[model samples]
Target: MQNLLSIVIIGIGATAVMDLWGALRKPLLGVPPPNYAMLGRWIAHMTHGQFCHKSIAASPSIAAEQIIGWVAHYLTGIAFAALLIGISGPAWIQNPTMGPAFAVGTGTIAAPFLLMQPGMGAGFAGSKMPNPNAARLQSLLTHMAFGLGLYLSGLAVSLIC
Candidate 1:
């Protein structure tokens, strides 16, 4: 029960931290925040046995895509948080450290680089992006930010516990 609470908070906090980075990227790097609705469209298509697309933007819109994207985004965060604790042990929640969090955050790069990007037609490591290097950097930095978030959230949760 205690671990559950910590997991939820840490997950949401880390995810929000990633979102914060996305928000700031627009001003800092001239890159707009990601459109989760596009992710939603991708997921929606999955329900119809379509997993890959030439361009997610060109994909047809589905009902409640925005809502679906937002929900899935947060849920993914929570799942990642769980993964962190699972790998680092529940004691991580009691005494959070940067090592595990950082490793997990950076390791999560695989998801987008290997799966999400290709599935969304962004190519591996966002190679299909207009500026592939920039896209890759953005993705890397975002994941790193998520790691920072996890560590910070764990510290906060530890204090509360």
Candidate 2:
């Protein structure tokens, strides 16, 4: 139960960090992030093997791809939190540094490379993008930001409560 809660917190925190980073970087660099909602949709489509294009970006899926993706997303976090709990035990669950946030953040590098980039038709981790190097960098940065967010948010929670 505690592990679940920690994972949820880490996931939310990481998402927030990614959002804030995009917002801050967008104005200065005129770079826009890929649509998060669209990303979510793409993830949802994972179970149905519909990872082609975003033709149905705005539509709903009967195959439960979207729901599955959302659930998987949260579950990933939970899994990370569980890892942290296992590694550090209960005492570190609320540590905020080496606990929930760290575990969640550390685990984020895989999604974009394996799932997200491929779904976006960019190949694994953006290898099929126009510029593979830039795409890979973007994926790394975003994932890193997410991980940092997880860590920071967990820290905040620990400090506050």
Candidate 3:
């Protein structure tokens, strides 16, 4: 139970860090923040057996999609935390380090590149976007920031637990 709690804390913290990066990036780099509503739309359609969309934007909007998307976002963060704990084991929770956390966090980008993006009709690695290269770079940078978040969060968790 303690370990689980610690993981949750770390995960939430890490995800929060990533979100902070997104929030700041818009003003600092002029990169618009990701509209998680699309995530909600994608998930909402999944309930009806619609996994892939030619363009998620064109897909019918679901009621309360924003809520669903935000929920999914946090859940995904927790899941990533679990993944980190599972890979590193309880010992890691006891004395969290930066390397493993960062690796796991950054590695999660594959989900977007291979699965989420393609399913949302953005093609592989956002290839269908107006500027695929820029999109890909942004994604990579965001994940790297997530990796840093994981490390920092792990440190915080270690201090508390």
Candidate 4:
């Protein structure tokens, strides 16, 4: 139960980090505000591998993608917390140590950089975008934010719990 809460918090924090990362990197040539929610949804859809990809805006197939993505996002939150609990055990669940939390955040980079980008037809890290370098930098920053989010969420949970 507590582990579940931890994941929820971490996921929220990850979203927050994503926002900050985008704002920070907005000046970068090719970086766009990454859809952190998309990351979440991707995590969720990975469980099924059914290509559920949706966004909050209007585009071709946006509805299917967004719904699947939203569900996947929440699932990612749960999964992240579960992994943290598994690694630290129940005792840590009560007071998640920072290492595992940050590790989880750091670990989040794999999906976008490797799987999502290529799958989205962006090559790797927005290579398909006009400014691939800026796009790649945006991705890196967003992932780093996710890592920071993990640590921040863990700290919050440890303190509150």
Candidate 5:
């Protein structure tokens, strides 16, 4: 129970940090935040046995996609946190080091590059986007931020727990 609580706290904290970065990036870099509604739509379609789309934007909209997307976002973050804990073990959670946290956080980019992007019709690693290189760079940076968040969150958890 303690370990579970620690994982959940760490995950939410890390994901919140990543979200903070996104909020800051908009005004500072003129980069728009991701549209989670599309993610929700994609997830909603999964219930109907649809995993891939030619263009998620062009696909039919689902009810409460925004809410669903945000929930999925947080759940995904929690899952990633669990993955980090599973790989690093309970000892790491107690110690809260940066190396392992970063390794797991940065490694998570594969999900979007291989599965989420392609499934949403953005092509592999956003290759189909108008600015593929830019998209790739953004994704890399975002994941790195997530890695940093994981480390920071881990540190917080270590201090608290």
Candidate 6:
């Protein structure tokens, strides 16, 4: 039960930290925050067997897509946290380190790079974008921030739990 609580806290906290970076990136680097609505749209279409899209923004919107996207986004973060814990073991919860958290956080980019981006018609790692390198860099930096978030959240959990 305690481990579960710690996982929830770490996941939500780390995800929130990632979100904070997203919000700041627009002003700091001219990169707009990710559109979760589009993520939701993609997910909704998945229910009907639609996966690939030329442009997710061009796809028709669905009911409560914003809500769905937000929920899924956070849930994905939690799942990532579970992955980190599962790999690092309970000892990590008691003595959080940056290495494993960083590995898991940045490694998760595989989901977007290989699956999400390709499915959204951006090619691998947003290679189809007008500025693919920039897009890829942004993704890398964002995941790094998520890694930092995991470390920070783990520290808090360790101290409190």
lDDT of each: 0.93, 0.63, 0.89, 0.62, 0.91, 0.91
Tell me which residue pairs clash in candidate 6.
Answer: none
Query: Which candidate number has the best lDDT?
Result: 1
Cα lDDT tens digits for candidate 6, 1-161: 88888898899989999999999999998899998988898899999999999998888999999999999989998889999999999789999999999999999888889999999889999999999999999899888888888889999999987
| Model 1 TM-score relative to the real fold | 0.97
The deviation in Å at residue 123 for candidate 2 is 0.6
Candidate 5 lowest-lDDT run of ten: 16-25
Evaluate model 5: give its TM-score: 0.97
TM-scores of all predicted structures: 0.97, 0.69, 0.97, 0.67, 0.97, 0.97
> RMSD to native for every prediction?
0.8, 4.1, 0.8, 4.8, 0.8, 0.8
TM-score of 4: 0.67
Write candidate 3's Cα lDDT for 37-101 as tens digits.
99999999999999999999999999999999888887888889899989999788778888998
Clashes of 3: 0
Q: Tens digits of per-residue lDDT for model 1 on 1-161?
A: 98988999999999999999999999998989989998888898999999999999988999999989999999999999999999999999998999999999888889889998999999998999999998898899999999999999999999988
Candidate 6 similarity to native, TM-score: 0.97
CA error at residue 155 for candidate 1, angstroms = 0.7
Which stretches in model 2 have alpha-carbon errors above 4 Å? 44-49, 52-88, 98-106
> Taking the tens digit of each residue's C-alpha lDDT, what string does model 4 give over 112-159?
667776655566656666678866666666666776766676677778
- Model 5 backbone overlap count: 0
